[model samples]
Target: MKVSTLRMALLIMISIGGVNGCGGSGSSNTNDKSVSPTTPLAPETSQGITWEPGVFEGASNFAGRCATPRSGVDPFTGASYPDVEGSAFEEKMWMRSWTNNTYLWYDEVDDNNPADFTVASYFAQLKTNGVTPSGSAKDNFHFSQSTDEYNTLAQTGVTASYGFSWEFISSVPPRQLLVRYTEPNSPAALAGVPRGASLLRVNNVDFVNNNTQEGVDALNQALFPSQSGETAVFEFALIDGSTLNVTLTSQDIVVSPVQNVTVIDGAAGKTGYFQFNTFIRTAQSELIASFNTFIDENITELVIDLRYNGGGLLALASQLSYMVAGPNQTNNMAFETLQFNDKHPEVDPITGVEIQPTPFYQYEIDYAAGLLTNTLLPSVSLTKLYVITTGTTCSASEAVINALRGINLEVVQIGTPTCGKPYGFYPTDNCGTTYFSIQFQGVNEKGFGDYADGFIPSSSPSFEYEVPGCIVPDDFSHALGDVNEGMLFAALAHASTGACPATTLAGNAFERAAGQHKDGLSIKRPDALKSSIFLQNKILVPINAPK
Candidate 1:
């Protein structure tokens, strides 16, 4: 229903409560955008009353509806509908109210007692039913308010927020595995696998013609079957007709989400580089370490690379800005403001007695270290924060780009564009599965981020190569080289007399073909300048490469 209509209905409901009921601003309930349980069914002092359960629409795209049975027949061949195998639809319900910020479910609707079916009563209900949510259910609901409830579910151990998910699929039929693009610094990257090679098998299992998902799933399971990382074997068939088996352990190694920290080395000395890979949860720590490392190394030119990052945690993205741009830096709101599901059951501030829950979120900076540390953490001073970007950088990754720009950081971007993902989510659970949806929206100070189409890089890189399709074991044609030795070489060459070596290219092959430095003192550029490629502070900045 439209918010205006819902507000009218809520106002009418309040009027029925008598004289003291109309105390709130005559604002219609529909006008409230906060996702919390603020609707008052009982009077201010009322308590312990059973309430009826109702389903409310969640964010768009999920089609605000409960899980209902959907039966279908086999489409490929003749098969009876509903009776066909592998035809099952989810049967769950999701509800959202001001007092219930998450999507939750009840075993079954309690028509006889709807009020008792609400999420607010879930704790009490679970106790009465002698049931507990743990193991699979606990992992599904990563965030829970009840300490006891959380402890019980955590026993089996859940996949931490930053964990990886992989899908296994069968082999490619006609194409045969010609090559694989193990992104620079990816798992396949660490295995010393070059581009231009072939795949033989996964963990000794022969590749089936049509089991792509199975292959991916198998990889994930083998690599991270539980909370701990494990080693998995990959057998590759090179295009040269040679085969080799490589073993790689799935270690909990944290990727630098951010890279290329340097200051412009030329007369202008006005540019810098900083590349962000993902919004992964540890981005905050990694970014801090990077900036400090840059400062220690005396790098002034800045060229941020976010070309291949797909984004992860939004909170870390916000914190990254503070490390690079300094404190008191408020540009785009970190995450969208979130309202609590209810006024948590706490002793009243004035009377010291439990009361009905009310609105609790205060719009302000809630740093990673809470209020005390929010003011205590040290901040960095930066004149500019240039971002090197591409279409793959998304979600929380985009948050950093916008946040840096908001704080007036001089950001000169080079590459293609960005993956537009502006909203962030707080995962919740219901019916033994986790579901995440947009809970808040953030806009830069200039109000720029409706770009579902993605952000265009100010300067385009010179070449573009597919990430997943590049063959890593044998192909060196697309490798990133010394120009990418963590600094902007092209910018550096213009800043100094040095130039890139002739062999350096923009693809992965550059790594294998890069020429050694004269004495490891300056950035390198080709003598002929044939590639239109130059080194900025010894870092490789792209001119343009289409997604």
Candidate 2:
């Protein structure tokens, strides 16, 4: 289902007339649990994961960073806290960027409250637009959390994990937590956890008990342990209905954002296929390499797989867009313009740095090496693009689609609609928490960025995918790049013939059970389970909190 560009444009135009133009926008202690799950006596021998070729890997840097200097007094308790300047700075940063500070609940807030609530939570309490229909979905999803886990991922393009992402179909008693996909060679894979395997229990605790808080807490503890190398017992049932128990020790699993790069043969010459998992700095090297292959093959069409990508750096998005469109088309085109609140729409709300449009970056930036070197970008000089997406595709990922389309390039979006986050943030850290509020709205070249409800696919009839192709359902049964893979197959089929296939998007179980579970109780998704899609290179500028 591919929506025509004219129709999409009209939709955006209509939405812009009525939208609020972008505005701004808790915890309970549960029964104390052991810091580490009780160790099991005997563990089963590990088996090597049967990995499909081209699955990505992760890496990390041993070099440490000097912590940014910060400190602030608690707004509620008047207790001057030192070494916590980031939180206070983060609060002020939001005060400047929130699209609608006019409607905040600042005057109504009590100055004297619990000491537990710091500048981050206090500023969070001020988000009022979330109550309205078109407002922010103010939830823990709007928090600022800090973790070494994400740092390793963004910097080195790697992360520590059990090597699998779990999806809970339901969140209550009788709820089912299934293995979404096991990273090749991940602990979960080595322990025999496969895609569609039902996670039965963790450390003897049922995945879902009638008690919501306790069950979630236990699941979180097991799923997202604080440190690597910790071991836990996992009980799961495979798709074939065989239930088994395996013990897995957390390891520094490298999570490569780029999954697969290959050519899908088609009657229309050749189509370059790239399964991109995230827009990280580490991906540039691989992208360059893949494009070199495409150049040699003389492939003009492309299919980009971003089904599971939760989004990352905007800089990388700009870089990829440049590679796709090439320097000629990218030269002066504003890839993106950040729209802040009415208060300070023209200047940097947080950094006081000049608010400028981010042009298509011609070079790659690697933060770790602290160097900006120009590499020969494999420029396809594509006039059209095919982006494989899902509801999970968001933030900077969406930016890629929007930016490409903004420049008059034909962009055919396949799979489910994007996660609908044109909004992004410069991750602010306060008290070891990375906070991302809807700081700004991103508009493309034509000034069209009205995708708050997500990009709906036109089911009017279209091909599987060719790149420069159409929208379709996500198929998760096979490994990426395999002809059996749904999205890739669609792209290949569409490339072979610029027409729709007689395909049935029947029973998209993966979409049916991704983070949509609300088991009788209000289940707030933590950042770890589902991360916030973000733009990189944007960081919090040091600012003092209000007295």
Q: Return the top candidate by TM-score.
A: 2
Minimum summed lDDT over a 10-residue window in model 2 is located at: 5-14
Candidate 2 lDDT over 402-471, as tens digits, reads 8888888877766666556666555544343455555667798888777764564553524211224455
Instruction: Give lDDT: candidate 2, residue 295.
Output: 84
lDDT of each model, Cα atoms only? 0.34, 0.54
Model 2: CA > 4 A from native: 1-120, 131-141, 147-153, 208-216, 369-372, 459-471, 505-547
Given candidate 1, what's the lDDT at residue 198? Answer: 51
For every candidate in turn, the CA RMSD to the true structure comes to 20.2, 14.0
For residues 1-547, write the lDDT of model 1, one tens digit per residue.
0111000000000000011110123232223332123344343211222233554333221222223222443332234222211100111122223113321222221222323233333222221111111111111111122222222222111222112211111123321332323434445666666544555565775543324556545633553333334666777665456776777655433334444444444554544456554443344455666666666656555555554454443344444555566544443233222221123223222123332211111112222222212222233456565454443445555656665565456554443344444443343333223233233334555555554434543223332111101111122234322344322443344334333323332453312211121222111111111111000000000111111
Candidate 1 displacement at residue 345 in angstroms: 25
